[model samples]
Target: MAAWGQRLAGVRGVLLDISGVLFDGAEGSGVPIAGSVEAVARLKRSRLKVRFCTNESQKSLGDLVELLQQLGFDISEGEVTAPAPATCLILKERGLRPYLLISDGIRSEFDQIDTSNPNCVVIADAGESFSYQNMNKAFQVLMELENPVLISLGKGRYYKETSGLMLDVGAYVKALEYACGIEAEVVGKPSPEYFKSALQEMGLEAHQAQ
Candidate 1:
């Protein structure tokens, strides 16, 4: 533990994972991990830069802020980093309409985008909405488009829910990929680009963050 601390001693900025670290989504809602709020307060007291990084694609940034606040975490919208913003940027750059397969809770995040002639299938944690009909619709969209793309917010396999381990979006993304014979573009955590962006947002180089 001492060696571990030494290794992370000079980290100017801390990028923290939201699920399983700060809180657990056991009940389908964030259940704050013991000491998490106080730990964050301590980090703030230390004047260390902190950012919450999550692969959760089921909530908008605003919604995440609210949830964190409600759970007694001192976090602002700016301090939260999730895949939605980056995904939106990619969508805009590619100029592709989205055939979204995300949760209704997060649908508003893509409200301004055009979906009239979708050529991209964006899959995320659609929860109960990941039904056969919706999957078929997304698959159909991909097949029909001249050169469609498959975008996955994150490729996490499972998450701990109140009901125990539950399948995450990766499973569904893989299924779609299998059916369509196209690989998904993952744009969330574990992606080097995503890490770089988060570090950049902290005004630090990659080496300065941990």
Candidate 2:
């Protein structure tokens, strides 16, 4: 077989990571990585299909698209793929009400959904909302459900912050899994299906795209 570089020489499409690639989350809102804007512009000019894949479920799709635009990247909402849509789909299909443990800034993403009589606990980067009482409440909700399902947007262990590397939602999700004796259904990066979905959106198969 040819070398990896040779194999990727004919790549027609790209699925790019958001955090730590195009931008860094150290500043909370995110600061563009050096030369990322110009690089993305070059990619756009190349007429190659591109999609921005992010595990950040903290913001709605629209919000993320707007942020990218503000940062000087020529991107559209259609080119963005995040876990929120998948999470919403799973909740609807399973008929499970969400006991959302997400950040206040992004809570509006699920505002339209029915959260009444929650039977499922959905966890994300809750920031200050990851309180002891709230965690206990989520634990209690899981215990009450006959068949509880824990949905984790992403299993990122830690993330870069302005201060330093801080624990991410995955750490909390793991704790809950250990306590509840159940695994969380992860719906973001590192999940092969998620990557495949992004590739599908770009109209390219995994092997055809990077």
lDDT of each: 0.86, 0.86
lDDT of 2 by residue, 54-159 (tens): 8887777788778788888898988888898878888888888999988876787787678999989999878788999999999999988888799999999988
Give candidate 2's error at residue 137 in angstroms: 0.8
Top-scoring candidate (lDDT): 1
- What lDDT score is found at residue 106 in candidate 2? 76
Number of clashes recorded per candidate: 2, 0
Which 10 consecutive residues of model 2 have the lowest summed lDDT? 22-31
Provide the TM-score for each candidate, comma-separated: 0.94, 0.93
Candidate 1 regions off by >4 Å?
A: 1-6, 26-28
Model 2 segments more than 4 A misplaced? 1-5, 26-28
Superposed Cα RMSD, model 1: 1.5
lDDT of 1: 0.86
